[model samples]
Target: MMPLRLLAALRRMLCLCLLAGPALAASPTGWPTPYTQVSGTSVDWLKTKGWWPLTVAWQPAFAGQNATVVALKANALLSRRGLDARFVPMASGVAVNAAISDGSAQLGAGGNFPLTQLVDQGAPIRVIAITAPNLKHQVIVPTASPIQSLSDFKGMQPPATIGLVLGSSAEFYFQAAAATHGLKLGRDVVLKNVSQDEQRRLPAELAAVVPWDPTATQITTDLKSGRAIDVSYPYNVYQGSFFVREALVRDVPDVALAITEALVEAELWLRLNPALAADVMAGQPELRHFSRPLLAQQLAEYNLLYKLSYLYPLGAFWGRQNTDIAMWLFVQGKLGKPLQGADYAARFADGPMTQVFDRLGWKIPARPPYIPADFWMNFVGNTLPAYDTYLTMKGPQAWPEPGDLTKPFSFAGKVHTP
Candidate 1:
């Protein structure tokens, strides 16, 4: 009884629905069903698997980087390619390391300090890329406190106690700074491990709080009662690394490559659209309460230091820096023994990162000459007698000479041995 035109329309509609049925059925809950097929990419693999989920362990503190990843997910970049990506928030780098260790997440980003600590502790993880460098940490004191500089700590009665998160870069820098000034960590001062919130509530007796951004800025801006005494020892060259489980890097390289590409693309997008990226980050649920201007300011600061263009060079440099940090830790008595440059390099998997850059036609810059230990010591303007003494004991042969970064210095299986 239906008209000929209506009958034909009904047939077309039924055919279209039938064609979409499999895609709809294959898509997991809350994921878009791709109508068009993608080929020869990570997304294609996701489509083949019916849009399986990929989990990334994330820290909220890495705002700009976090924003880019979130943007990728929100835009259905992965879904369109036939996969779902999720970011799971973690409290600290330690938590991220634990999650990766237990197989709860495959990818994570964290400061070089904790990452180095974990690697030295024998976690089967590898840093795939150095995403950013020059992250700042500050030592702050109550505006009225008598402790004006590092010199005040020497031979002070009742030894000063500085509040900081243990195993954090803040702690590492604090120890380094104290050592440079001839102050023994346990004997000269007390390091009380405190949370960010606890840092604000530090009693009158506490000497200072050593914290990284947001918390560092918050102490000065929001509290208005704190003053930054000194920036961390390294001063504008500390790094943050993107890490993956060793098994993932070894077993499924494609997934690691895809992640590196995604990160690089996200970083590029952020750079090209800074204002939009800042606004987008401000709207994130975790960051919504923060002022848009504040978020934007933080974004600007991050953009200045971290550039996707220098990814490879930065990774190579940080690989060497990580060993330097390990040696510093050893001299501080925190680490059992020094880590050699080669063992540090072994923890870095550069294959996936190089592949991503190649696919994008990005040129990897020539590696920079290695900065010797004495260079950093002079740069910080603090003579580390203990560190100097330790090097003296090891002799010149054990030290990595300038321009020798390319050659891997052997540990000869002596790592972590007391």
Candidate 2:
């Protein structure tokens, strides 16, 4: 019962892979045994779905929605490159892990943090690629807010009301910033989850806001309206990418390779097609009124963050930050247990990502003005990724209604929940 669009996309990808795969360079990793060939518009693979033989790409771009990027990538690869593949949608990082583990999904994106968590817990998930790494999730408040510094929250006094997601990278840094300045939540400040309607108003009612998943593109109206202002997180605390079960990888690594190639093309399209990027952002009713150009701006900024992380530090993400960030989280008791630096990063597969970047000759960018605010975290703060949304900033993109995750047999296949 997957969305028709999703089913169509998966069918398209599989056909492309089957058709184009044989022409691909030597598998280097070899292909799965007993592969079958088909040339129909739809797949007969799922007719008897007890872990049907298939490769699926279920990574979420930007704010973790599928169907958009996956569909676009799947179609392009199928028509132009002949990659017979399937792109599936999952609801979350947790869901992606589950699908791959359960065989409903062969592969999905899980990012460094989540991958690290699951791997440390001993799940069979393995990293096949790095969609993004070294991206710092920033913390932002209103540009004109009275909150002077990261440590100023200590004065908010009993039940201080601020806004941010409780378990995200934003909270990780907020906690770090507080500790660095000797501030404590519950004793000094408290967090309030904001609704879309309340986002523009939250800055006005609260001392300041630290939105991990902010709705507004920037603090322009909030601050211009004399509501509040904006500040940015100095560094990121949580990191995430594509994960697949080790068994699937062992059985069919070419699917992983093809997916990596398709994603590279997709990311390139997203980066270069700023004026139309929103076309690939997928459906999220909540983002209906959000400006496409603004989302594009956020995506560009997020991608640039990736460039910074990739270029400035370890030269590649390689999950080092995962160790640092996870270590910080564990010490703060955000995570259940302590994980070793080596153990945490062991889950990342930067080789694939690095291969893609190297093939493209990409390097960390020079400076900030290199991108624009709307194209960066100047809006929703750090939670917004820095990829380029292909859209004209002047026009607004209507939000598409997302599939109900609660339903059965959704396009998520056995993997929709991811």
Candidate 3:
């Protein structure tokens, strides 16, 4: 018997799917018809389990997540692949997590902090794929500020107040950088929770603002008033993950694989059509204020590490990073109890991504391609493989668009127009 909450969610899902039937039918690829098999999972097995329309809770504030949403909205991948889904945009990871917790959404996309919190609270959630592994964050100060670096915060008469969307991956980066420089929150510095708009203003009261791109880009490039001191690369390996309810992986495994494949295709489309992708992002209300060129820059930076040959892997190091974050949060009293990486290690579902890469004819990496330590040391003596090696590892899909990033980079049986 299904729980009452889940039953209600299913009913809502069916209603939404019914309303979206016309759109699905109108899709250029058409809706996914009954395939005998998809990614080794029986199509019949999937239908019997009641996996129809899915509600994805995604935050549009982040660049990569926003692009993926734009791709999903354009029916770039989901509909043709037999996954009937609607995307509900959330303001932040907290809202996405809430939607997932209440069963309103089956899959949620968020950064490391939110994913870690979900696992720490013992939600029946498992991370399925890496959406944006190299997502960047920054600590920026006003142009006139006396502060030159993270080290400047030490021994101030009055503790400096830092601004950020608290409890976010920005906070995670700030914390890591602060500790590296021996600065402690509340003693050496104070934190003031600021919204995205507040960060943009670069308020005089706050000594520095920690934000993710294109917000960071906007502050530095668009506004030209803030200068970033410490970026994400050397401080933290900022990552975005798509996590699904454990039941989805357990029952409708094929659906999970389709979701992962759709993400890969969507990102590929994004990489191929960055200008158009930026236009799509600028179409969003919150992003309307940002210029098209700035948006494109954000897209390029976010997609730098995403490779078709390697795709994104949910491997050992990613698990270890999450664990380290969870432990750090717990030690900082952000979480009520101690939680290790092992606590959530079983939640990482890498097989579906492996299958997607297999179909793409790309090499499946044993772990994520880059880490903070690798960036810190410039990869001179790192044991891990470098980005150049991954870039050269392309398969059937790697193309050099004559003018456009290798001729609009083909995928899913059609040349992308926008």
On TM-score, the leading prediction is 3
Better structure of 1 and 2 per lDDT: 1
Question: What range of 10 consecutive residues in model 1 has the weakest lDDT sum?
Answer: 409-418
TM-scores for every predicted model? 0.72, 0.60, 0.76
- lDDT (C-alpha) at residue 240 in model 3: 80
- Cα shift from native, residue 237, model 3 (Å): 1.3
Identify the runs in model 1 with alpha carbons over 4 angstroms from their true place.
1-52, 186-188, 233-236, 313-316, 328-337, 368-418
How would you encode candidate 1's per-residue C-alpha lDDT over 1-418 as one tens digit per residue? 9999999989976765553343332222112223333334654654453434666888776644466566565555545543466788877888888887776777788887777776778888888766544555888899888888877888877788899998677877887778767888767789998876677665676898887776676667766779887776343356677787776567556666666665655655565566877787777787654566766666655542332444553444566557767877788787767877666677788887777555433445454222344553454354321222111323212212222222121121211110
Q: What are the clash counts of all predictions, listed in order?
A: 0, 56, 4
The 10-residue segment with the lowest total lDDT in model 2: 404-413
lDDT of 2 at 260: 53
| RMSD of each candidate relative to the true structure | 15.6, 14.4, 13.3
Q: Sort the predicted structures by TM-score, highest score first.
A: 3, 1, 2
lDDT of each: 0.62, 0.46, 0.69
Best by lDDT: 3
Q: How should the candidates be ordered by lDDT, best one leading?
A: 3, 1, 2
lDDT of 3 by residue, 307-359 (tens): 44334545466666566577778877888776665666766787787776544
How much is the lDDT of residue 77 in candidate 3? 68
- After superposition on all CA atoms, how large is the RMSD of candidate 2? 14.4
